[model samples]
Target: MSQLLEPFREAYRNMELLPLLTETALKKFWVEYGTETIEELEQLVEDSPSGDSKIIFAGHRGCGKSTLLAQFGRRMADKYFVVFFSISDSIEMSDVNHINILFAIAVRLMEEAEKQKIKIKPSIKEQFYKWFAKHTRTEIEESQAGVGVGFDLFKIISGKLKADATIRDEIKQEFNRKISDLIARINEIAAVVQGASQKEILVIIDDLDKIDLGVVRQVFEENVKSLFQPNIRVIFTVPISALREVRMAGTLTTETNNQIVIMPVSKLFKQGERYINNSEPISEAIAMLTDVMYKRISRDLIEPEVVKKIIIYSGGVLRELVRITNQCCRICLRLIRRKPDDLDIKINAEVLQEAITNISIDFDTRIGNADYELLQQTYQFFTPNDPKEQRFLDLLHGLYVLEYRNAKLWYDVHPIVTEILQRKGKL
Candidate 1:
């Protein structure tokens, strides 16, 4: 038993002593690195209560949307009645109709309101609970009993409610009315609270872009548009790809048109820019991001050099930095058995080279049929000095693989990804 304990103790101590290669626990570290965006979001919520505006936060995957939401939640908790919801984990958002998404938003908000000790009128709360329960029941029953009962019930409800020409129209109108009424009730509560304390209500919808692209469009273009109100401020995360999809769909409505604020991750990291009106240097931005990664991993595996490598690889994307750091740390742990001294902990160029090679190979395999073709095209058309080369650099920047400092002068791909590409002969 003592022998076994000795090994465990040694491992723990080694972990403490070792330099971290990557960020493993990003959510916790986010508190330190997310100040700029959190402050901006707080300001937006504060100012939006007096006007009608919407903020659409757009970034690549792993760009710290969840972290931003968590930090913003904390910042707004004191003054605003903040309700946070993330749809990334829900399968319904990917496949089912968006009614479930609305129901989810209401349920999450009500729960949050309760947690915050906000006194919601009992009648409104009860009605909302019942509506959510019924909606959930309908969804479950439909899934279990097949579409026959669901379609029949839908038709029955439509027929009974219809004073219009089509059952479909009737059902749509009824759903819309219920949703509107719910939003109105929420507004009423917000208005009363604002009158009392001059505070506002913020509904933070994180991971909006993580859902199915189609559902995202439906929610923003159709459902969410109707739900927007002056007293209610919404901050939703959107993928850059999804934004392009929205633009392509031509579904940008009047309500969503000018209200859309593309809050790029780059904006928060800009040099010398204060939250209110200042900018931070590139060095400061990198340092903050490194601190964030260090905190996330409990300072267990990442070292300063590794953080620098991750920052370079991340192409100025916070999320990418965190992810690459996390991955590298995991790789390092798997490779070393008896945990060597400080020398062993250092993630040298070789380790990074290996990681990048594997990643590039994985990417190539993922793009199977087009791997060779794309590589050839990339090599032929991608001249480092050409303007088109800058576009390619931008593409890599968008992918969080490389950062663009100037025209065609770009840094190397993340050590991990670069290694992979080299192994695959694509570099």
Candidate 2:
């Protein structure tokens, strides 16, 4: 009895609530969208004259965009020396700068180079620490000889700069003063990576999309030139909300040469005047959604109809699906104790609806009727066109409004959110 419950307990204990970072998890739960997004990126890299490209990829938070980028880096590892890192992992999202981003990239590059037995010049390290210490007004602590000095130095610099706002500002000013030098050092590291791997360096900086919209504007809009100045093949994740607000001519535009690529949501619904599941082609989207749960837990442990209901509620967003499924697992455990049905340990519709009801309660806390109508129309029809409908962007970020693609793009409120609205006669 204990042995049977152990796997069930452990699976939830090790549930991947965040993006998949390891290759093993990625392989076991991977799903193909039949979307050529990665292929387009590869083609761009292959056809580039200088073997260098800078791109901005945007998607809603928790939309598996990070997972997609990570898979891309893994797939192209043979041809491109891929170094993927998350910016928010090292810096505070509320207060981020392009310089902080560049610094993180440089540190990650150095780390990757060391992994590949390539050495970064000690002079570059010394120069970086010198500038860092000068701006922060701190004395460099003495270190034991050859005691992982590079690694220790990196930790100290990143830790201090992120924590101390005064130090961060000073460093930003210093970085601005020596922006050209910083660029040179970054390019120098890029050169080594390309030379050692016999391929171009591809840096996928993930999690920038998870930052605040204001910071997104600061990094990609106001400072677009500086952010894109790094002389390397790079892809930076931007927030989906930024696309509707920022001027796109230089960075994100329809121009063939523009660097931005709006990775549309992996298509789930068929194109029509009305929304319907893409069942005619008989794709395995539903199966992929189920496989994600099975990869973590046993299939028989979960009822197929329960999983299907959760998938529909997820509105085809991968993170939303995982979240709802996680809730359902909890519901199943509670229901199992009441009934003691060891022979049929599965979630059912009643518990699934209860789980969704709990989630919907949170959705009801702050919405006004005007916002409710905006959400309703956005969910039912095409995406709302009124710039005043910025509340919809908030809904998008909050996972209440899901972005989807047919021939063009559209938005729909999360099933649970809509359920709450309809229950109130607003939809």
> By lDDT, who's the top model here?
2
What tens digits encode model 1's per-residue C-alpha lDDT throughout 208-236?
66655556667666666564543466666
- Cα lDDT tens digits for candidate 2, 261-301: 66665444554322454444224667776766667767666
**Per-prediction RMSD in angstroms?**
10.2, 3.3
List the candidates' TM-scores in order. Answer: 0.64, 0.87
Q: State the C-alpha lDDT per candidate.
A: 0.49, 0.70
Question: What is the Å distance of residue 36 in model 2 from its true position?
Answer: 1.3
Global Cα lDDT for candidate 1: 0.49
